[model samples]
Target chain A: MNTDPTRLSAAELAHAIASKELSSVEVVQAHLDRIAAVDADVHAFLHVDGAGALDAARAVDERRASGEDLHVLAGVPIAVKDVMATKGLPTTCGSKILEGWIPPYDATLVSRLKAAGMPILGKTNMDEFAMGSSTEHSAYGPTHNPWDLTRIPGGSGGGSSAVVAAYEAPLAIGTDTGGSIRQPASVTGTVGVKPTYGGVSRYGLVALASSLDQAGPCTRTVLDAALLHSVIGGHDPMDSTSINAPVPSVVEAARRADVKGLKVGVIKELGGEGYQAGVRARFDESVTLLQEAGAEVVEVSCPSFDYALAAYYLILPSEASSNLAKFDAMRYGLRVLPEGIEDPSAEQVMAATRDAGFGDEVKRRIILGTYALSSGYYDAYYGQAQKVRRLIANDFSTAFEQVDVLVSPTAPTTAFKLGDKLDDPMSMYLQDVATIPANLAGVPGMSLPSGLADEDGLPTGIQILAPATQDERLYNVGAALEKMLVDRWGGPLLAKAPQLTAKGA
Target chain B: MPPEHARGRFVVREAPRLAPMSALSRDDVAHLAGLARIDLSDAELDRMVGELGVILESVAKVQEVAADEIEPMSHPLPLTNVTRPDEVRPSLGAEAALAAAPEKEQQRFSVPRILDED
Candidate 1:
């Protein structure tokens, strides 16, 4: 195996597998090798299904050899977040409670990815219960940003983005409860999209805040992202809330690369405060490039954005606290008996199970959630937050009235060093401030790398937000910016990544 | 850790302790933890008290708007009947499901004895 592995892109990988130029086995082996060599240092994958992935890849190769028709994603390797349940693949949600528990069934999205013939690359690390913006809260160790090990990769989808950026996989799936996908993509210099809330089914995805959670595609290129989005974005009878609207042709939009006559709204809030200088410079330059490409840019303001973080905290934890209630010792997950209490009472057993299984951050959120949803405070807190959530949604609705789409810096800065702020949960929560509004509003948002952070010299991104059903606008604009940036930068961001000492590639 | 003096309407309202804040004093958090069936070390409880206080304060901004007339919006998107039909669907059979359980007696998953005599 070459120390500097030059693997195929999504299209190339798919074509090679289909045409028999590259057997699925070889493609799967390359990635498994990549994981073995460097993933120890990157810590991107929570679990690597070496044998299972190869066996599945081999099945794809055999089918193609038998002259069977190929699925668009046949033989592709996609990493799943640990938050998404996969049959028998320790879906721990980065917490010790679910550490050794292997879910008996696959999540809805997992089944979709599997049916598409994508080899499950294994579960990637994420924030415990998708609660934190950085994966540091993972009961497992944090995933280091591929750009610089010292910096974080962004979370809770940081591990997913890192695998793609590090070339351990060509495409991955991430859940964007509140910018989990987009924020990490910004820092890691990859493509991440949070489809309209109903665009992707959430049946199997471990819930953080159901209203805010939606799984989207993360890939190295816009076309690739669009392709994966099309496959995973659709209605499901299982999830009645899934939109019945037809999934628009995002791949065609990427292929068209036509930005003419599109009105892109520049959200005034996300531009300056806490934005790194390089990020702003790049964002401005990209806007100019889009303007030059025949797209009109307009300044749009959403004042409710200032309060989005507050609303998100209340809603997410309240929802999470409830959603996670199923993991009692009575159901699945850890069940412990107290140390000294012989034949402990049920209450003691419950306390022991919880004390041993739950982590600090998880406990903290549950407490906060219980308090928010508690009776006397319900109207003042939970009820009020829901009202504010509506106001935030109203802000988006109003903004979309004047413009086709909205744009802003995806994150304040590029990926920070792992452990830089792990001890500080408040600082960690603040990282998702820029990306959470869309989740509250149920809007579709995509993040594509704009420029390197001048301060840290790592990738940062700008987010594209479009109206609920009008997700096509994101593709129209994202593809345009992606094409422009790649042409200037010479290639994808991961192309410049140096070989790692551990995972050679 | 959060500032003790940082207590505000936002903090108190958003993450109010269990009980009326009167039912349990320093033990509200502990009792809440117990109710939720999650164990909390002294350090974790201490941290949560301070964190919850500050968060509740920050979340106070939600009340600034006049919501007396506003209806609670459960979802951002408009909703009608979002629930699926209660139609019969194929489910796993006993053999398929019990085949993988860590420990199973008969058809049901047999976990360790969880309850003590009430």
Candidate 2:
């Protein structure tokens, strides 16, 4: 058995616990210790529930001792993005507005994680309301890339990806609305998936863009993602939009890991021009490797994808504006009285609270959404964006007809320095160009490390997109590509990252 | 090739070739912020005017191919009117529900004055 339980994959740790080789308490404690040692520099977690995790781990050990049948992932520890509601845990959604607001009920996915007996480590950091491409928007703080401490891990789900890459947790849950999950995974050299839009229940996921938001897995390996996915996915009575179908056989597909005779499409629109040269090189090499493995590779065009970013900006702001309207200093969350007012009216108080609570980016989107949905501009902006959404979806349908799956570089570049694009919102928005189309179309997407970029020696990721409801295909191809890449590098890409010890040690 | 619906259609609003980049003004942003119930500081309003202009200019590209014949898609799924059998079930107790509220009184959410004193 591995001496350091922190280094073991969630699958291996689960196996060891099930076989009574390593107790669940030891596994959970090793992760808690890892979080203690390295999380200072990584800033991957907003809170670490050490006591709660130990209690859960102890219960699992007792259950195993009593010869109780347990779920496959039972006893394995997991981290969750702060965006999802956790019954008794703070779910701030990286915003000051909801700071210290503990949910009354667990999100459907959180309930599933608890039911599977996975010990919850705590809430990870994120962009405020999952709005930005960089986690710098987080009111708490940005999560730094484990590879290069000065660089971004990726936004919205940066903390989840960082935790997995830094070995703070073997598995984490991340929600993707316009590439939150996959983009972070790309920059961090970890695996992240955005399942089909309705594939996972969104009952207690604080709504960002109701149409685009979907929670999926963040993990060190493809199989671990599949394992976590099956546990959290499936229909829920609480989420009316959740797909009423069994989760695809992702575990079986992951183990199959054979891409022979598979038709792979390299998206014509997603590469060249804006893409970093090193990113393109890694993607091309990955495609060649796939061809060498007997998979047929072809270039397919989804021209309508050219407008996907534009449509997303409009649609997301429109929905987010409405979704965020609930934080009006009324029912819950932070409340502030208007300055210089003896008796502030409800409207005045709401405005004051919002101004004090929301960060610049959140306010920007809310204002944009408000304008988009306003009287005369509604048809010109929101309605037109909706039409474009259909066009993008149609493009996916057309492309999927020619190929089994579409592929691209997950993000346009490797991790940039923390403050590089902070001032320029448009430049930051361009980072999600390749990953957003999958979310807009509601198809599943997976991002796995392709290779390190030659120029910067930073990790680059290859993204795989499958048709809606055919999520298993992503795992199948992702696992196959990951295996090939690992064999070439002689280990996982994360092995190349700079090692971190306890801060000030 | 354009999709069937988008091809050869006379649209009510012809897609603008190049929407003016500086179309949004500081006053417009302030108005929008007011509508959203956010009291933006003058500094924030100034910065947002520039930032949001760029974003709006870029996102305006969505109007390019939004032909009249194309249908608007609100959601990825085709689900509509999803319902379950009506039955009383366990729910959050009043205390639990009001636990996180900023102000609560008499088992209900308390708020600032909504009407002027008569």
Candidate 3:
């Protein structure tokens, strides 16, 4: 009961909850209070089910009282990004189109989390249908950066990043489509991982560029991600693309983290042009740290990384438009016809539904996707984009041949004000520069907290990328760097995070 | 930069510029929208036509460097045969499947008839 509530790490909280130093109900209540207090300004969550969360917490408490053996993450509070469906929870994907729709089933990842005994806090916000790089595209609203209330948190996982950064929750799950998780983590100074493409089951995740989407853990510490990721990742029969493989040994990799003798390739093209000086400085510093840790640092150029964004825009939007077609008002989603009309034409209802349901960014992509898929343009646009996708994958494979892993500043800059880049979607899309390649190549990528942006003093992140299916490499390198950085900084990156005590911490 | 990199996908070559279809006019955007079955107003079409051009221009960078000698990689990982074998398994039948349809009669979903579609 006396566990210091606000600042505890997920690992610490899990131990406390299991040892009875804290009650699951108390843990959920504290997070709920935090969300209630700080989230109004941060807008991290589109919907917070305080009552539902409390009920789940009480269930965990009862199980423990009955002397039931529990899972490792038992009673720990977790937030699900709105992009994933949770049974009975409003899984809106941060869109007004499906505002009050409750899902009938949980995503496979969510089911795994609940099975692990983690308490579901609520659904956090995300870009509308996970289409935007910034959460600004979310029809409900953009999530504010927790470090600075006025700045934008990265997206479409921005809401999840903000919730963990703001201490509204110690851990949350997020999906990454072209850097959604890592980019947000860069801006929020949290740990975000996008596992290998088929690492986690996508059965219940709202489809957003299915080929590019993969869900992973976002937390304040590397070990925390390892813990959560282990529980949710593995082969699933429900997803045809799910890898029929054992979960990578992330937890052990974290514990045995050592960068000595490893080769780290600094992608020559990632940092030089279009990146902020502050971000580059921190990236250079990270490379130096890696070298000092006995790892050989070298520059490996993945020129294909330069064209990745162009390839992604073509591929992702094309996929998004097709996927989102399921949300037609004729479906189980919103149906808004004329003010008063029975048996309105399905065409009119669908037109009205998409117009109201989708935001400008989403609509823009859908149109572009439609154009690309059009018979007249498909061979040139979609065909070329798919070819370029192959080129990018080749570039990653070639680069890994020279280096054990690649590193870069997770994003070009730190957190920006919410509205800063919204006006120009191109600039917003460019923000995923460091993150897109891994997703494009179907490999693994993770962002570890680095130093703060000199200008805004908000946290920045450094990314570590690995070859496909070698997700354990990311944890091995990431955990080593995180532990070293924490030791140098005298604690975890969030140690200096502004403490916002709930009504009664 | 390395040549013929491992797990190679698209190849990038320097082009004086990435070229997109200049064929798209304002009317083209409107026509494309209709074909896609999404409704867009004139004002929306006006903006979309221009935005689509730039997006096309930006993404056309892919076309600049890829050589005809290179084969495109559709997926990053070299994975194949991601299918489950057919087996007798329980499934939610037609009643449960169409349970949420807005209009239903005699175990069938009723909707305003449209041309063949999903």
Q: What does candidate 2's lDDT look like per residue over B22-91, in tens digits? A: 8778888888888999999899999999999889888987776745788999999897888777989999
Question: How would you class the docking of model 2?
Answer: medium
Restricting to chain A, the TM-score for each candidate equals 0.97, 0.99, 0.96
* DockQ of prediction 3: 0.38
**Model 3, runs deviating above 4 Å:** A338-344, A499-505, B1-23, B82-110, B113-118
| Candidates in descending DockQ order | 2, 3, 1
Summing lDDT over every window of 10 consecutive residues in candidate 3 chain A, give the lowest-scoring window: A496-505
Off by over 4 Å in 1: A1-6, A502-505, B1-25, B82-87, B95-106, B109-118
Off by over 4 Å in 2: B1-21
lDDT (Cα, 0-100) at A388 in candidate 3: 70
Error of 3 at A446 (Å): 0.1
lDDT per residue for candidate 1 within A314-420, as digits (tens), equals: 88889988988877665567778788777766567667787888777788788878888888878877898888787778888889899988999898877777677
TM-score of chain A of 3: 0.96
Please give the distance, in angstroms, between residue A16's alpha carbon in candidate 1 and its true position after superposition: 2.5
**Candidate 2 C-alpha lDDT tens digits along A54-153:** 9999999999999999999999999999999998899999999999899999999999999999999999999999998779999998999999999999
Candidate of highest lDDT: 2
lDDT of 3 by residue, A1-505 (tens): 3355756888888888889988989989988878877877888888788887788889998999999999888888899999888877888888877787777677899999889888888899898888776788888878888777778888889999989999899999999989999999998889999999999999999998989899999999889999999999999989888888899999999888899999999988898888888898888888888889999999988867777888888888889889988877664666666446556567766776777677888888888888778786675677777877777787788889989999989999888787888767788888997899888889999998988767767788899999878888899899888877888889777767666544422
Model 1 chain A poorest ten-residue lDDT run: A1-10
Candidate 2 chain A: 10-residue stretch with minimal lDDT: A496-505
